[model samples]
Target: METRQEAVTGTIGCATAVLGAFAGIAVWFPYGRTALFGAFEGETNPTDLWLGLPVLALGGAATAVAVLTAVQGRRRIAVGLAAATAALAAFGYAFDVLAAPQALQDCGSPC
Candidate 1:
């Protein structure tokens, strides 16, 4: 049987890991697709690049902080913040992915 401390640590670790993984996917999945297939021709909207890179950095920072705090048992607030950050990044990536189609559709050939 797991002790109380062990159980708590295990739960925290699991949550932190899941949060971290989702955060990674949130950022990577969108950008990875662009990298794999190449950007749309005449795609000049810099918004995706501008938005994605920062969130990935923020998510990374949050994940690091969450894992550290969870391990030390000094704070749960950081873990909560990390989860929120991950969710926000996921939403942001989804937004960018969804918007890409519309953005491309709006571009016209002027030449």
Candidate 2:
């Protein structure tokens, strides 16, 4: 049986993680992908930077919280949420590297 405080922490952590994941995915299509690739090539878009910053910040914060919850609660659900949060945070980079190599190369100023 979990205490109320533990439950609350788990809930907040889960919600934050979900929100962060959603924000990351939502921005990735319109701004994140191009922004990220452009950054690699020294041609970042202002719009992408503006949009990506907050999303990345949220994801980082959420991941931290989820990890904290998992460690503090020592519960299976909390652990699962932490793992899911981490995976979601990594999904965009994975997609870019594995599935969108051509797209990345196409972005940024002509060489």
Which candidate ranks first by TM-score, i.e. highest? 1
Q: What residue runs in model 1 are displaced by over 4 Å at the alpha carbon?
A: 1-38, 90-94, 97-111
C-alpha lDDT of candidate 1 relative to the true structure: 0.62
TM-score computed on alpha carbons, candidate 1: 0.46
Worst 10 residues of 1 by lDDT: 97-106
Q: Model 1: per-residue lDDT, tens digit, 1-111? A: 889998987687666666665666575656645643446663444455556555565575567657667667767777696777779668676766324533356558852
Per-residue error for 84 in candidate 2, Å, reads 3.0
lDDT of 1 at 47: 55
| Candidate 1 residue 97 C-alpha distance from true site, Å | 5.9
Clashing residue pairs for model 2: none
**lDDT by residue for model 2 (20-100), tens:** 666555645555565656545456555445545554656655665666666776577666656665665575464432233
lDDT of each: 0.62, 0.58
